[model samples]
Target: MEPGAETLYAYANRRRREITEGVNGGSGRIVPVTIAAGTFPFPIDATTRNAIASAATATTLAGGDAYTVPSWLLPTGRFITLDATAIVVVALAISVAFQAVFSAQAAAFAGIADGSVTTHEAVDAILGS
Candidate 1:
């Protein structure tokens, strides 16, 4: 099994539970689950790919009313549709760096403000801090 398969399975199971339990005011509609197995490399063996696709379709048909997982939960589809994966990754990296930098700055400022160190001393402490 692939790394994402478990997550997908859990997502489907959660949706199944939600549908059966009537989380949305007792709708009582059976939600269908579709699990499409996809290989890592593009253009996989035709037969296997077709079989997986067929299984996914059959699963959808077997369950009366189909309810798909939200876009964010589907890795490939969500990333491709939004085209924001790179942007999000960059943003998160910058955010983490900024937090680290600011935290160090704050620590230096605190030391200076509390009279634990002079401006020059704080600058040296900050460099070493």
Candidate 2:
């Protein structure tokens, strides 16, 4: 039988978790966050996700203006010293990449529900797995 909506949604949730945890199929996606202090390895994990969301919100509220984003923490427990413009650029890119992957997963789930997708391979293709 074809996969049910519950099963497909579960798979999609697992894919999102995998992407956030940066493990299993989601390994090796390191974002090199460069700031005035230096470059740091930003893992695709919960903390980085929160940071991106916060930064994105700040950028939006600032209306694309430049200023100081003070004391942004790095993975190494060190803080980055950078102005708003540079961090906004990095945040925009990171958010876009994540949004694309998640949107693909959502599309896969929707396609499966609508009978447009019938195979595991098709779902994987849409989800980039």
Candidate 3:
């Protein structure tokens, strides 16, 4: 049989046991999902590159739904009329990474800007060398 592409997932954070007998309102448990294997990285293909180029302009043009760009990236769906791929790629590059925009930081400071890493080699979308 052909496995084709096997996605082996190992979940890191799991609540072994809930809050004991009489706990307060919220203990503040969070579901953390760290990709054990590589997943959707900053797409480097020609198509993705072109999309990002277009979005780069849109980002500035359609600024300040909240004034400042957030640190942890997630598409706001603010630019749905525009190209989705472009917006996502551009956003991932700019706001998702650890360092400033496109700094080639590695070793303790790896991010989407590190061209050396790829989906196959990376454990996470942004990783430290």
Candidate 4:
């Protein structure tokens, strides 16, 4: 039988704490992804997050349809070039993934509070695959 939501909540909470502490199940905070330009190891540290936000805003303000992230911005020393349409698609995908996780986390919390949690469904539902 699958573990209950309470157990899943505990596991998720611990993982979240570990990620905050830069452990992340020994993978650390870097989230590596492959775009058309190349692979980018996106660090989730505060500094990098801030930089990404600033860069995203700058891209919007620059009024350009295309944005080319320089190689230096990537941990793998590769570039990421995306036009506005592609950027939107990528951003939507990311947003959807985050929404799923957050929704699951919230559902777990609510289940814990109300004693309504049942069996586990799938990894993709509770957490992104």
Best by TM-score: 2
lDDT scores for all predictions?
0.35, 0.69, 0.30, 0.52
Candidate 2, residues 1-129, lDDT tens digits: the string is 777777777877776767656665444245776655666766666566677667767776777665566776666777776566666666765666667777888798889889887776677778774
Residues 28-119, candidate 3, lDDT per residue (tens digit)? 21212222221223423233344555565556566623122233222222222323344454445534432321232232123223433323
* Over 4 Å off, model 1: 1-83, 119-121, 124-129
The lDDT, on a scale of 0 to 1, for candidate 2 is: 0.69
User: Model 4 clash tally?
Assistant: 0
Question: Model 4's lDDT to the true fold?
Answer: 0.52
Kindly state the number of residue pairs that clash in model 3. Answer: 0
List residue ranges in candidate 2 displaced over 4 A.
24-44, 52-81
The weakest ten consecutive residues by lDDT in model 1 span 37-46
- Sort by lDDT, best first: 2, 4, 1, 3
Model 3: residues with Cα > 4 Å off, grouped in runs: 1-39, 66-129
Candidate 1 lDDT over 45-95, as tens digits, reads: 223234334434544565623423232222123321111332233223333
TM-score of 1: 0.30
Clashes per model (N, Cα, C within 3 A): 0, 0, 0, 0
- Angstrom error of the Cα, residue 84, model 3: value is 10
Give all TM-scores, in the order shown: 0.30, 0.61, 0.23, 0.51
Error of 2 at 14 (Å): 0.8
Q: What is the lDDT of residue 70 in candidate 2?
A: 73
Question: Residue 50 of candidate 3: its Cα lDDT?
Answer: 49
